[model samples]
Target: MSGIILHHYATSPFSEKVRIAFGIKKLAWQSVDIPPVMPKPDLMPLTGGYRKTPVLQIGADIFCDTQLILRELERRHPTPTFYPGLARGLAEGVAFWADHQLFGAAVAIAFGAFGDKLPDAFLEDRSKFSGRNIDRARLKQQAAVMQGPLRAHLGWIEDALADNRAFLFGDAPSLADLAVYHCVWFVRERARSDALADYAGLNAWADRMKAFGHGERSDLDAKAAVAAARAAQPAPVRGTVMPNALGLTAGAMVSVTPDDTGRDPTVGELVALDAQSVTIRRSAPEVGEVHVHFPRAGFILVPAKA
Candidate 1:
């Protein structure tokens, strides 16, 4: 019901990415700290099924996935652009490498080094992942396997930085910088490893991103966030037909929900829709008092007849 509501937990690398973006954009947003693990009852009513971390909620509109969220933010505020014109493609390429490749290796190292040291409180919050304890020894072995690939990637990043562009693309900070920051922050905060210190340019870039400061980030308990979400009224459902990008016909009673992870899924009567996204209304309290949205690309709006 506020300007921006972010449902996320502390120490989530992806969440941190959005936090940094908010800081860079200088936007004030509400914080809704979701459970680190499963049984996210409060969040479910909004996302329907998608459970990925760091969901962005605006009024009744919920945006899942950090990439999509970032895109929305960019569309809203274009000044400090994350994708600066010609560099957009390059920035996206770097972000992809960082999210997939770099994050893969960073996570491997983090669990390998701090699996045991992880706070009991944090571990307990992850009820879903609680029983599946990490085998540090195995994690270490996995780290070894990942290390070579990560190091090679870092070396490539280092060479890019050697060009003295300030940011990965040059001059101003971009999405690539934020993606890289979260991974490096994970290594420093969780892993406590200075392995990246050897990469001077990368280190310097990290420092620059850090200078942005995590804007308006205040701690909120998961229960509190859930309570706030429950108390909040769902946005009014507009009667206009939604565009159909999913090849569904108007009047098709399909459930427009996010993909399962734990996040709330948006469900409604399939009105005007498209292959990209679908709009739904909360006809039942189970779906909450809000209009729900789903990306046709990622969700399945199964026709009620099926």
Candidate 2:
């Protein structure tokens, strides 16, 4: 086993982003299918209360959020770099735009088209997860409003590819391409609707991205994943805590929460902190001591309350 286990569902857009990256890197990994909605009993032991899709597990280390997950993947396997031509900063900026704004528009368009067909339980779960009323009627209304935004975002992509570049940054698909592709994939593959029918440039780029199929994967039981964590120990902390406004120190009790949807908090002893990411050590009876990592940009970190 490569010891790389991904906890995600099949249709998850974020999961698709990571899956395509795995394809780009040509990596072999273990897959642990997780519930699309809630009651992720096997996952709780690794992530505490942070209920998010597509958590990346490496031995006893848990990486939450796709941003950090992709970064970690690059750190581990840098042969086929995600940031070609040292475009890390620019690629990450593009990823941020696609992940937030473009994703919001794409998902709205998707739900608007198919929300009526979704089960009540899935709708309810999504509403709770996003802290919004996610009913069919609301989705239909939002979808109509989001069409222009989605079109505009796709227009940007079309403009970028005007020169006939193979990928967003260059001839190679950078993280930017993966980030944009997943939202587009959700709209077409999951929602069964294309945002725009005739963006020649954007359509061609999408076709190229789709060709990078997910790399080698094998299924593993959820129970077996929990057991793997229990059998291992977290890697030694790698970096010192960078100076921060919070004055948090190593071993301080702290909690990390998403600033956006799915805002559940994960509390642990502060183990590492840097400009790029944060790590904390937490223990569960089932998984023992595990280090959970989160990207610093879209997450809120603070001293854990009593």
Candidate 3:
């Protein structure tokens, strides 16, 4: 059985976060490249309706959301902890800000200031999605709104950097540092502007984090990855359920699937259960899958009404 399979796309910022974590932990994992847009047939059976990037699959168990995935990775591998003891609370706060606030700002800038900088090929690739032009316009508007908040947030981050700590919390890098680093990386790489140039400390911090190369990151075509996943047999469903503490149930029928661009299955019968996750078995040949699980807390599971 594969240890852990990550379904994600290259340009996804959230996926970048998990990729970096994999690098930090020095762990090897199977990579499943999902589409950047919708029409995700193969993935939906695993995720049900959640159409987010970067879903982690372990055997029959599927994990969505980067935050939960991070915790799971930490639990599986304790060394190089993302949540250092002294700065745990601070780290959590920073991560929250990055995922919501910083990411929001970065998205705005990505669509507004740096849209042209993206290679024509990149744009063309994304153009495959319906209503590409409309999406671009909306993204630009989002960028404009994000710019103001991001600038203010950057100012605050500058002051935080002034504390002379090697990281957000001290000499050691914490989840906060990584969260901040990836958001900044997206801005710098995608925006290609000096929006943050004025913040010397922030620049230095970003440079330091860059030294930790995301592990085994290579350009694998999205189509190829999907094909490989299709060719490979769905891993057997383990009877074990994600712990109840995680908040999933047994007997609830659900179709475990991903949310990106792949078609495998539409629905499945959710069987094996626990507090944390529920297992889904797909009948569709294209979606023939087993033990698709979702985190109880992050996902909504409505009992199949008779």
Most lDDT-accurate candidate: 2
lDDT of 1 by residue, 93-197 (tens): 678678777987888777667767766665554433333555544766877787677677788778888978788777888988888888888887768876666
- Cα lDDT listed for each candidate: 0.70, 0.92, 0.66
Model 2: residues >4 Å from true position, as ranges?
none
Error at 47, model 1, angstroms: 1.0
Local error of candidate 2 at 46, Å? 0.5
Flag the better candidate by lDDT, 1 or 2: 2
- For 1-306, candidate 3 gives per-residue lDDT tens digits of 446678888778888888888888888777778766666767765555556778887654566677668877887888888877677767767787787778867867866776746665556655553224435546677776777788888777778889877777777777887788778878887567677778898898888777776766444443444444444555555566454543545544544432322222224565666654455655334434444445444344544434
lDDT rank, highest first? 2, 1, 3
lDDT of model number 3: 0.66
Give residue 154's lDDT in candidate 2 (0 to 100): 88
Model 2 clash pairs are none
Clashes of 3: 31
RMSD of 3: 5.3
Per TM-score, the best of the predicted structures is 2
